[model samples]
Target: MTIRMQPDYRLSIAQIVPRTEAEGPGVRFALWFQGCPLRCPGCCNPEMLPFEGGTPMALGEIVRQMGQGLESHGIEGITLLGGEPLAHAPGAAALARAAREIGLSVMVFTGYTLEEARQMPDTAVAELLAHTDILVDGPYVREQPDSTRRWIGSTNQRVHFLSERYRADDPCWRQPNTLEIRLREGELAVNGFPARSAVGLWRRPPWRTPRDP
Candidate 1:
């Protein structure tokens, strides 16, 4: 599939973690783009929803970083997360193309359903989907929060295996939620879908007993 580059070759990114085991099938370099039109209720990364925020980065630079991540961290793939990755189709497509050229599997998480995304008028969106190995799609519904599924937020979200790189029958994909925490530069970032119990624990103070003040 031919992938088209954005006219400016720039992507507005919320964040990029060089390595993370919680984003996909294996350890991966995760890229979270900035800007999202669909403000899905109970979105986990609301900070990334603003279109005007995030650093505008060159596609080349982002690809260069992914390459470095592969070499330095021995990552298995790249996971594209966002503020609706499909909203920035061109740049996201370009990034996916670059990652695949180097033999890295591409996994994308989006608020758009697979059928809805396929109907998009933009060819870039199709191209991006073509290169994607696994796509987790659907809006995050607060009423359907999922804890048993790996790498997905809500029960309504579906995981599409576009390529044979991963199998649906694999137990790893259906395992209970697991969270990966990273401490960098004194900032702690948590990745992955946390179980309800985990969320409660995270909210509770370590020093306090269940009934203590």
Candidate 2:
């Protein structure tokens, strides 16, 4: 019998944003991949919308860069953000597998809901999920803001445990609650607000012109 192998797809990385304190877990190197169909309104990095803009990077080069990042900064782990990680499942899975081989846990942020990932046509998404330790899944809702929350952007997104570590009946791993926050900056900043004091509606002058003040 002969064994056939699948060719690895090169990933298009929109941008590599590093040493971010906000993303998740700890100081981490984040990879923002190109191409997202969801196009959620008010997405912070709208520049990542186009699929053709990023550089095409091979799996080996990506892993090497991550290893270098880990060694240079002693960071905790790598977080995969995107135009949508599930968009390039094969490449992302390859990257995540490599990261795991190097002893780094993977955290993936996706616009797809947990149910959506389970229904993805591409088997690669499931493969990537298998390798992923923590998955923050769902599209961002402007009304359901993070409010200076720790890891998620909205109240609807759920964190799923893909590893065997999840017990058969663990509620915490199954349905974690959305976080509520009050910024130390002052008044409570609800989800999606700037990481500072909440703004008072009275502060804005109704008479102010749009272009001239």
Candidate 3:
């Protein structure tokens, strides 16, 4: 599948962490795209379900921030989450390509299984997969929470090393998942996989623009 080129692409962003160790192996720039079709019961970010609200950000700005993450935090990669990355394939692909051009690895978490994604007619989905070094696939099954894998949400999800950039036996995969709480400019933001009991402790700051889902 060949993606249609759009040099002036933009993304509807739910959230963006310029540098976060909780998102993937090593520090990375993580993006949560706005909106998703799948209504997995107990979706972690319900605020992101609607397609309307979110910051409309230019692709170039996102790429710039990614480069800044590399220089300031020495990040090794970028992680694309949701809402649903496949739902925002065009911008995600553009971001993945920009990450690769800067010598950073690309990791994506998609609700669609690899087989399902491949079967889809979306050309940008194929392009995103082509540039992805790692893919965590499958819907988040709230009944089957994952405790064994560092970044996985549920046991139903599978990790695919789409490229040789990472391996199953990597020591990082064995580490425990962690949650990050950021208090910047009096805004409280939390991310990463946390224990079910800990989910209610952190509340989004009232002043946050574009909101978190």
Candidate 4:
């Protein structure tokens, strides 16, 4: 595959959380890209589904932010989530390369299965996969929601360790589901593979009581 580098690269990003423990192993920076081709049901971030509505950030700005996260928060690596990271393959590949250059491990979550991604004619997709240390692939299946696996939404999603940064034998990957809730400026944001009740609880108004006090 011919790997082409994108000069003056920019990514359509939904959000960038500087530090998060729930995204991957250890403390890590998380980037959620703006668009997705596969609008799978039960997607955790439906806001990321629209291809055109995110901030178009320069690649250098993103790298600089990652470096800041590493320095200020001692982040171990970066996790790329989406809409679908692979949908923006070239830019995603460039970002991953930049992250690796700074000695940070890269993990990616995608709706494309490994086989499907490998067969894509786009060299950018191949290049992005090449730079990924860990990849969680397969579309989210609402019927097969998974709570036992770490960093994946469904049982059908498979985790691939493309490099030595992490291991399949690691207990963290098989542990029961976990989540993190962040309350910022009176807004609540939940992260991780949370169960239905947890989501419901989060959605419930804080002032409301069981007895309607």
Q: TM-scores of all models? A: 0.87, 0.71, 0.90, 0.86
Worst 10 residues of 2 by lDDT: 200-209
lDDT of 1 by residue, 71-93 (tens): 88888899998888999998889
Candidate no. 4 TM-score: 0.86
Candidate 4: stretches off by over 4 Å: 1-8, 174-176, 195-213
- Sorted by lDDT, highest first, which candidate order results? 3, 1, 4, 2
Model 3 spans with C-alpha error above 4 angstroms: 1-7, 195-213
Candidate 3 lDDT (Cα, 0 to 1): 0.82
**Cα lDDT of all candidates, in order?**
0.78, 0.64, 0.82, 0.77
Better of 1 and 2 by TM-score: 1
lDDT of 2 by residue, 1-213 (tens): 111123334778875544444455555666778888887765655656678777776776667777876887666667888778999888888877877778777889999998989898788888888888878898877678764344566777777766653333544323332322333223332221242113211112111211211
Quickly count the clashes in candidate 4: 0
Say which candidate scores most in lDDT. 3
Q: After superposition, how far is residue 146 of candidate 4 from its true place, in Å?
A: 1.3
- List all candidate RMSDs to the true structure: 7.4, 10.8, 3.5, 6.8
TM for candidate 3 is: 0.90
Residue pairs that clash (backbone atoms under 3 angstroms), model 2? 145-191, 146-191, 146-192, 147-190, 147-191
Model 4 residue 138 CA deviation (Å) reads 0.3
The deviation in Å at residue 22 for candidate 3 is 0.2
In terms of lDDT, the poorest run of 10 residues in model 3 is 204-213
